[model samples]
Every structure is written in C-alpha cells, then in structure tokens.
Target: MKRYKSILTVVAIAILGIAAGAGIKVYSILHTKSADILDAIESSIDSGSAQYAELKEQGRFNILIMGEDDVEGSRRSDTVLFATVDIDDKNMRILSLPRDTRVQIPGHGVQKLNHAFAYGGPDLLKATVEKYLGQPILYYVVIDYNSFPAVVDILGGVEINVEKRMRYVDRAGKLDINIQPGLQTMDGKTALHYVRFRKDALGDIGRVHRQQQFIKALLKKVYDPRILPKIPELTAQMMKLFKTDISPALAIQLAGFAQNELGRERIFFSTLHGQAATVNNLSYWIGDTKAANEFLNAPLEMLISGDVAENRNTNNFAGLSLSYSSAADENGNGKASGTEKKPGQVMKKDELLDLVRSMPESIAVLNGSGKAGLSGEIATRLQKIGIEVVMSANAKHFDYKSSNIVYPINAKPEVVETAKILGKLLDIPSSLIRSNNQAFYPSVIIGHDNQKLMSRIDKLIEISTQ
Candidate 1:
C-alpha cells in the first residue's frame, strides 16, 4: 500500500499552467514567426466567459487546492489549501490546512478535515473549508500524487536548500527517501520525497513548510527563461494531471495577471491557526475558529505587509472590553485614583516614560506611513526611553490611517498593558491598541497620523534622558 502525499504539487501544476500561458504570451510576442503559438494564445484569451470577466472585476476570489490520495479503496485529501487571490491588488494569500485538523464533515458528524474527501471528494472538502473559514471558495483544483513528479521533471527540476539529511524507508508503502542536505536541484521523484519526508519532530507542520518552500521554488522555476519554450508542453501535461473548475481561458487570463502584475513580494503563505490536542484518545489539530476567521478577514494590506511567523499562537479576545478610569489603569488594573481618564486620554509624561521603561518585551516597529526610514526614527526614540526595538522595517504598503499598537492574542497582561501605555504616550486612540494573533511580538505600526509625532517623541526622549 503506497501512501501518497504530494500536496504542494497541485498548486505547482496550477501555477505551471499559468506560467506556461504567460511564457507563451511572451514567446509569441518576441517570435512573430510562431503563428501557431500566437493563435493558441489568442484563442485562449478570446474564450474567456462573461462570468470570468465578472470574477476578475470583483477584484478578489478564493481557490481551494487539494491533493488526493487513494488508500486501500477510500480517497482522502492529504493536503488542503485555501487561497485568496486579490486581483486589483495583485496579492495572493494561501492558508494551508493540516489534514488531521478536526472539523465537522457534512453527513459524517465530526471528523478529520481530510476525511471530507473520503466522504465526498472535492465538493465536500470545499464546503468544509468554506464553513471553517466563513468564506466562499470560487474554484477548486484536485491533483493525484502520481502526476506530481512528471510536472517537476518537465520543468527540469527545482532548486531547494534541504535543511538536513533525510532518510526513510517504508517497505509496506514502497517508499524509500534518501536526500542530502544543502542546496540542490531536485527532479520529480526527489522533490516528492523531499516534501513527503516527515519523520522529524515537527511532523506534518514541517512538511507543510517544505511544501511552501517548494511552491516558491517552483514559482521561480516557472519564470525561468529556459521554461519559456516548453510552455505548450507543460500546459498540456498539467491539464491532463489535474481536475479543476477553472476553464482554460480563465487560467490563461489569471496566468497573464500573475506574470505581468504579481511579484514575489505580493505572494503570502500561512497555515490554518490551530493547536495539537488529544480528543477521545485520538490526536487532532483543533482549529481556532475565531483566530482563523480574524486572520482570514484581516485586511489584505496587513496580510501582504506583515511577516507570517511560523510558530503562531491563538488568543481569543472576542468579547473582552477594556475601559480606563485613570492613569493607574495603565498598570493592567482597572482600579485607579483621581478623575476617570477616557479611552484615548494621554497619560502624564512621567507616567508614560515609566511605562516604557518597565516594558517586559521588545517590540517590532513598522512604518505604515509609506515614509522611508520612519520606523528606524521611531525605534531610535523608543530605545532612548529604554524600550528594546527588535525589528524596524517598512510595512509592505503604507495607506494606514492611524498608528496602532498590536500584541498577540495570547500576549501577557503586562505586554498588553505596555501596548496601551505606549499608545497613550504616542497619543494613539485606545481603540487602535488591539490584539492580533499573527503578531510575532508586541509591535507598533506607525501610520500617517503618527508621522508628525517625531518632534513630540523627541521632546519626551529628551526629558526622559534628563
């Protein structure tokens, strides 16, 4: 019995198809004598339906990709990914779902996410994912593992830096993986083995990471000039390997968009937020619904701009509310003397300095104002007040309206308190200080509204130093 798990290859095939179309377009443009190639490109483009145009006009859509495996006589999805493609913004965000994640499978009660495929194939899996994320899936692609290697071989292999030596043998499954570490180009079979080897401590999570890495590498290979001439061949091969609702014309249109507009910086990847738990003696990854939904509903700006930390922790602040009655409330306790301070009220300068000095964690400062060097400047001011600045960089895009202090959902009370105090010190509204499960650390996103606070922060720094 061979166990198949070539999940990322499904995505690679879709991307390859798009890349092929893009390459053909480029090739046709350069070689006018290739009348046959040019005609195919024209025909694909002309075949676009009104629905496809409407979807493009809608600006964004979700796609679900599943890698199916036949075990004994039942089919299960070994890997599931939900993708949100923002057309107008030229950004693509993908969230990988662990196969063992516990979910409500329609007509089957509660079961592993992968079990949905065994129950009803792609349609049920799509519905399960949509219900899980609270969003509609517009398209789906299902690819068998057997066809994955051929696509990689077609591309002449992909370059990947294997982190460690991998050796595994499963005679029962007819699987034998042996790969050396470091940078190497992998052909179809080697790449499949590379992604499927999951005997390490991280298990499936590690495999997911490897798959993501492979996807990126595959994308790079797809754009390689050497692959341009092989576009037609690759496209035909991919069409035969995958089952998808996307028509040839729509795929070509998207491929053109990806090649022409989507850059490496615009692509983002994340895993479904969850925790490993044992239920009824069965190990399962319990999905964090609130945190996952928040992540999915998060603005595209934030997703594209912020780094997706590998070790994500969930904090559910769903119904919690905070009210500050006085300066003492900044200490994480609501009890305080004197007149009640409103949510956005500024704390005394001395108090703000004390809070900054007492912060328990370092913070990453991001310039969401679109201004160069803004984060570094703020970081300097923060360091002057004894706050450790761990990272300083520009947010991917800079259209933020106001500054925000963000802490992880499961952040320590002191950390949350630090964010609130920092917010007051910087004159940011209390509402702007909130929880974000994706935050790697307590962070400050300096928006356009806070760009003018340089002088104010300078004065505070000077006074604190004195």
Candidate 2:
C-alpha cells in the first residue's frame, strides 16, 4: 500500500525561510554584499497582493495535495488531501480522501478516485475532487513518491510511536516492511514504510491515521528552535521535491500567517468518512457525500469545537433504525408505563436481533467506568446476544460519563448500522456513538451510565432474544 505525507513540510519550510529572511533583512541593510539573498527573499515576499488579501478576508482558501505513483505503466494518485486554510482564524483543516474512494471522472464512468490521475493526471483529479467536494480548489501540490524519502531525510527523520507490529512483503514492487511496535526515530525509508503499512484490519483508514500522526510529529520537528538556522538550505532542498501551483510569495505569506497566529490546538485533521464496499466484484470505498459537504462548509468555530463529530453521527444515523425499541429508552421505560414512543422512532425487537446476528465486526468492550470486570461482564452480555466480543479490557482512562459505541470512520455501512443497533441494545445514547478513524475496530466504551444498564442487562437480553 502506498501512502503520502501531508504538505506540512512545504508550509513549514516557507514559514522558517521567511522568518529567517526577515531577521537577516536588518543585517543585510548594513552590509551591501549580504543583501543579495535578502533582496531575492523580499522580491518573493512582495508577491502578496490585493487578491491574496481578498481571499484571506473571505475566511478560507482550499488547496489540493496529491501524491502520485506509477503502477503497471499507469500513473495514479495514491494520496488525495483537501487542505482548507482559514487565514483569518489561523487554522487549517486537512481532509484525506482515500485512493479507492468511488468517484466519477469527467470523461470516464464512475471509478476509483485515484484513477482520475491515471485518466488525465492532476488536472482531472483536481476537477473531479472539486466536483465531488462542491468546493473550488485554489491551489494544488503534486508530489511524486520517489521524492518523498528525500524530503523526510532532509528533516533528519521524525520520532513516532509504532502502535503495532507491521510486516509486509511485496516482491513485485520491491517493497519489504518489517517494523516493530515502540517509539523510534524513523528515517526516510522507515517513515515511508510506517505511513504505507495498511495490511491490518482498518486498512487505508489505519494508514490515514498514521499519516496524520506523522504530520503532527513532523510539524513539531519543523518548529524546533534548532531548525530555525537551517531554514534557507532546508527550504531550497525541500522545494525541489514537489510541484505546486502556489507562488513562492503566497506560500511564504500563508505559512507565516499560520505560524504566527495558529497554535498546535488550532490545527485540525480528519478523514473523509466513508464505508468499504464491493461493487461488481471490485472493492471500492463509498464516501458519504452529504457528510463531506457539511463538514467542508461548516463554520470554523463548529469545526474547532468538535461539532463535526456530532454532525457526522447525525448524518450516519439519519433514517436508520438505530433508535430505542418499543420496550425501552435510555430511561428504561415502555409505552404501557406512560413512556410513549416517539412516532416512527421505535425499532422492532426482531430488527435489533437480526442486526446483532448480521454484525460483521467483533467489538472490544472497554471499561471506562472505573468498575472492575465491567468490560468482561459487558462482553459476556454482548456475546449472549449473538454479538462477538473479541477483547475486553480497561480503557485508557476511567472517567467516562456515558457509554459510547466507537466505530472506525472507514467501517462498512453495515458495520456502522450494526454498531448503532448494538448501542441501542446497550442503552447507549446516540450522541455518545461516534466514528473514530484511529480505532482498529468497532468498540464499546462502558461508562458510569452503564451501571444502570448492567442491572437491566438480563432483561435487555431477554427482550432482545424474545
């Protein structure tokens, strides 16, 4: 699996080079001979004009970053990223589109997103993505995978914690990856392997998460004080690695704005949520277009405030039979006891049972309620209902207020639907059910609210089974 790194290096180098150039301007004024480099930098900086300001005032500008590879004599984009730069707000939102995402090409019928590049290179891919996203892309950066390693090497490697043992061998592609789990400094080759390892259950979604993590780590390295003095040389070397439509001046201005105004907290990263599917015997990722549009068009505050997650949950569960059954709600009441079911909101007992039976992914029940053996107990209860419980363990922390059913962003539609049914079965509120691309599988995080559910588990099982 081929993966691409984020465009943080491009922005980071621009910011560092501009900062260094600004500092050198004063010294250059005193020494005529030293002014040549400063003059060149100043000329580039002068490229910022009224149009750039107008775009900035409009709140955000979008950039498309693509990484391409040659396979079987055809060029295809392995990575597609949409970067929304909120200049006024001093933040950026990067959404990665999986290569296998099903999309329509201009002259071609519906095909994999990567095929747009193979069909007409970056131009077609850009137009296809813009059409798919319903947003205009103002600039584009295309990086060839061959140059990726050189860029990483220029940064002196990045430190990252390998979450698991990754081992893959592709003799045809001359690729061999064998990386163990632990915190280690990864050089160019190793970093490439780290981002490209997607053989695990999560597949491309897993790779996307690692790419985001790697970007964050790389950004930290770029901002290190020691790197300040080497900006000019690093920028010169790195600039040669990628092809972009962004002007040197505009790149500097944008990066400077980001570096000066944004903090680590302000930068947000997300993947275009979707599900894996097979159409006509060929595997493809079906993107959630509605959710993607809402996310792209949402207000900066909402995006930063974590409202996007809630919005996604709403969109994913819309019109789905993931609601409470006629028997109970979170308060544990039925219509007979004066707890009237909302019109068209009740899921039949049979439907819930069928959903559990058809669930494809095993869930990891985690105890976040600070209760001992709660995960095991819940796992057992889930298994009783025909749901598989693959792992039961303590959560990273134990202060959760309400139980949550967490599924990966790239989970199959059926998996998500089944997760919702599972959530309803456990009396978990829809608000707590979320999609996390970082997760390896659909999981149940048992919270303090689940204590009540524990007492009702037997009754719940009885109701579901009946």
Best by lDDT: 1
Stretch of 10 with least lDDT, candidate 1: 319-328
What tens digits encode model 1's per-residue C-alpha lDDT throughout 1-466?
1122222223543365445544454433322222232233335432364324534444466788887766666677787888776654445667778788898888898888888988787888988987777776767888777777888998899888888889999887788999999999999999999878778766776676677778778776776667867766676667656777665545554555565545554566655656678999988878776655555555544443232122235321121111111111222112112222244443466776677777777788988888888899899888887788899987645766556677775568878877876766776555456665446677888877664567667766776756
Model 2 ranges off by over 4 Å: 1-57, 309-466
How accurate locally is residue 237 in candidate 1, as Cα lDDT from 0 to 100? 69
Tens digits of per-residue lDDT for model 2 on 1-466? Answer: 1122233334453345334534544333322221232233334332374324435345456778887766666777788889776553445667778888998889998999988988887788888998888776766788677766766777788888887899999998888999999998899999988888889877776776677777777766765666667666665656556677665555554555545545554555556766778999988888877766655665443443233333334222222211111111111111111122122234567876776777766778888789888899988987886788889988766756556677765468876876787776666555456665334567887767676667556665776766
Tell me which residue pairs clash in candidate 1.
Answer: none
lDDT of 1 at 218: 79
Q: Which one is best on TM-score?
A: 1
Q: lDDT for each of the candidates?
A: 0.65, 0.64
lDDT of 2 at 330: 16
| Candidate 2: C-alpha lDDT | 0.64
Q: Looking at model 2, report the run of 10 residues with the lowest lDDT sum.
A: 327-336
